[model samples]
Target: MNQAGMISTSVSTTTMISGSHLFNISGHSITKELPAGKCIMSSPFVVGGYQWAIMYYPNGLNSYDQPGIAFTLELQSEGSGVEARLEFCLVDSHGRPSDIHKASSFCEFGYVSCNRGFSGFITHEELEESWYLRNDSFVVKCTVGILDSSVVEASGCGTPGNANDTHQAEHLPPSDLHEQLRKLLESGEGADVEFNVDGQIFSAHRCILAARSPVFHAQFFGPIGEKNFHNIEVEDMEAVVFKVLLQYLYTDVLPDLNEFGSIQIKETSASAIMAQHLLAAADRYSIERLKMICEEKLLGTISIDTVATTLALAEQHGCGRLNEACIEFLSRGGNLKEVMDTDGFGHLMLSCPSMFNLILANINDPNVLRDLVIRFSKTSIKS
Candidate 1:
């Protein structure tokens, strides 16, 4: 695609000149006198394979007090095989040719040719190439490619990517997060498993397992033993938990979970039950691994009533965050009214009256309060 276009800039000056003496002597001509402060000149040229219009203005004079000229050149190149080149000369008030000098370094030159595409060259190079006048700033352009196949060949093809492929490859499917999690979870157990994290892999089972959990325990204790086992004042809790959980997977007998419960049968013992509940809660909330470790710790300490009591206690201790979780389990729709009416109610209210209030406020009828008091009184007397 051979297309041509032109860019033009205008210069203004405080230096004044009579209209008649400001004679332009290029193949182009001044078309119009602008307002009191300006004049307009146009150049006939081609750029990027099409004809373009150019213009110039006056600045303060050289040492001769003549009108110093500035210029704006615009070129538009379109269509194939378009080219132009032209020169400009200036005549001073004395009717003699003025001495020409190169313009400042900040002056810029750019050209767009049909075959060469768009390019910028130094103004000095532009002036030298076209034999432009240096006495005053002038824009010189001419139809350049008309006679020379060499210039066209030298310009090269303007369209890009002619020699290289431009198509992109299709995207592939994403890696699975579950698979990654499973791999990480199974890497090692407490005190023996080795794994890498953040580019550092420690061979010690204790260190690697510790990365998974706050509790650390030996691997032989089985999965249940691994629950609830946390290192005392551990340097890093996450590392400890990670290692403990890993160990639980490898050996179902978790020493930490075992430590909390009796050595006999590992069935649903108090500690084992508690551990299971904690594990279930943790898993339910998507922190299953952490829950496992906690369950292991509380293995012998959990029961339905105990969980309810803990809910109240957790609330009283300002562990309201845990209280919400505890309440979720306790609100499973049972004869909770009778349970609450016992002496346990006094303890419950004493521990967490706010939680009691929350429960009371949710009940449908206020008349139940008297029955509740009577029941509480009877349970208290019996206790």
Candidate 2:
């Protein structure tokens, strides 16, 4: 080799500003009289130039069912995409955070709102029974950490280059293999295999499908190859879902679910519906990466109306993380009762009765379940 080429580079640095605020409930018992969805907020404080406040919901927050005490850190000032990490814990007798109950969360506040906190910071029974609640009062400590990153320019000599003899180096463009593959999938110029899905035919290359999915590989080249190779009949999957599956198999990218409006799940977004169907297809084809992508998308869409159905889906597909998250979401505020009122909740109970034990495990208060069953029975009678 003649000589190595040198190029200057710029480095980035990040600075973190952290501060803690304490909200003390003087008469904790009195605050419990407040209804769910009502909150008492601490005085606004500034940390890293952003104003924030601690919202304390003695009964619960954002719901009519009062299952637990909730706390949320709210950004007082208007800001978009403000990233921060929050830690909420009850202060002990010594003014230090008690390890008994602590919740940590990271959030990127968007334009619509800036609130990130735990709905079940601590269950009512747990808080009343714990030593952290002293003299009929309790103190909640919130630690906020805001990160500020900046790029700092620094000069340095590289490769011990000779100044007298200067040379120009050619730079190569980034690879567009994925784009080319996407184009190939769209064109169907050399498709060797065809799939019949719900009366719709999709053409694809066997080699590309085999490279991406193990199930496809076995079907094309393994023992399953004894069957016809030219035309394959896919079962129980919609034409749209199979098309998206083929697209993912060809290119490593998953298209936005909103692109297609052919199927819509009631009370759920188009993306969520697509993700639900695609997750099942991905699981069937043994496409793990696609399965994970769909899982992550579903995680973001979990809400009171959708959590029950999502939980059922998680149980059916053996998605451990999704299952745990749904259980955790149910344990918060009045979410469980709210979800119980939905049709999906009925379906969940009927389809996955095994999930009851896991749900019971996360619930701190037993009376809530008792009340839920009684209330649900009354609602059933009325219906």
Candidate 3:
């Protein structure tokens, strides 16, 4: 906040020009003093589809009466014949551009021509008094116009004399199917099946499950269909996980992580455990979409303790996306040493020794890859 009781900024953001590019030169001060003919130029910055630079004279022109430095926002692109409209100004410490000193001029030049902004930008005495110069520097803002209203792209696929500017309707949320199934699942009016997982029974509609999952369809009504089975015994997953899986089958949306009583979700315990089991169940049920969805959820909540285990699951289930994410996260190299101490990491090494090769292969950058190997070696000795 400034002395005024309102919002504020250090350099005023460009807003006046529309359809034009603006470039700002911050810390625009030259350390070395220059002679009468010398000038310091800023590095080239892109604006309005062209390269640009700001040239500033440190000392005033003694031959002329101008006291401070003169600034020029010029085209830096070589071998380009262009006549560009330029607007330049000095911005105050409080981010207010000086409208009084701002200049608008046309620069016509190529690689050889003298293409720059208007002259006599500001005086030294004026700069010291004005709030524009703060911390021995100021901001020079420039806007270069690119096009007029007529430069739009040509459209119409041979339907002559008709503009045919019809736009497709915006995508609506996937609410209809999700809501209908959720309602059906909750009401249990058409529910025809019950799943008993870990001694907990979850009632679901056989038709709905079959429509959503091919495995369910096969199990309930396939070539060797066990159509008469009312309650099916589900294996290898906790009741809560099975319940959540049923919810996903009913609705396309994943429930909030917070809904599952997740405390410290980033660690190896319950948070990703749900997702891990969901991935396994999705794979078993041949629900490719659900498998990918679970893989993504597991990736987001991964921590040092869970990364190795997640990677192992990713490999086992042929989840290429999650597998890549795990390697990339571990390749940061700083966290590898700590991750190594976890029992999951031990299990990963024993079960899938090739994951180390995968991690090493993904670390293309020499610096981070080196750090990762060094950390792994050190951690291995300690472990």
The best candidate in terms of TM-score: 2
Clashing pairs in 2: none
Q: Which runs in model 3 stand beyond 4 Å of their true positions?
A: 1-177, 262-269, 360-383
Q: Backbone collision count in every prediction?
A: 70, 0, 1
| lDDT at position 105, candidate 1 | 20
| Tens-digit lDDT string for candidate 1 (1-383) | 33433222232323211111123434222321222224354545433334544344332112232233434334444443332233333332334321232121212234542122111112222232222333333332222223222311222323333321211112345556545544554553333534443233434445434444333334424465443333322222233333444445434334454444432323445454435433543343244445545533542343454554555545543343345444433333343454554444566656554565555433433445555556545545755
Cα lDDT computed for each candidate against the true fold: 0.38, 0.79, 0.66
lDDT agreement of model 3 with the native: 0.66
TM-score of each: 0.26, 0.59, 0.49
lDDT of 2 at 34: 88
Residue lDDT tens for model 3, 192-252: 8887888877788888889999888998889997766666888777777777778888887
The TM-score of candidate 2 is: 0.59
Sort by TM-score, top down from the best: 2, 3, 1
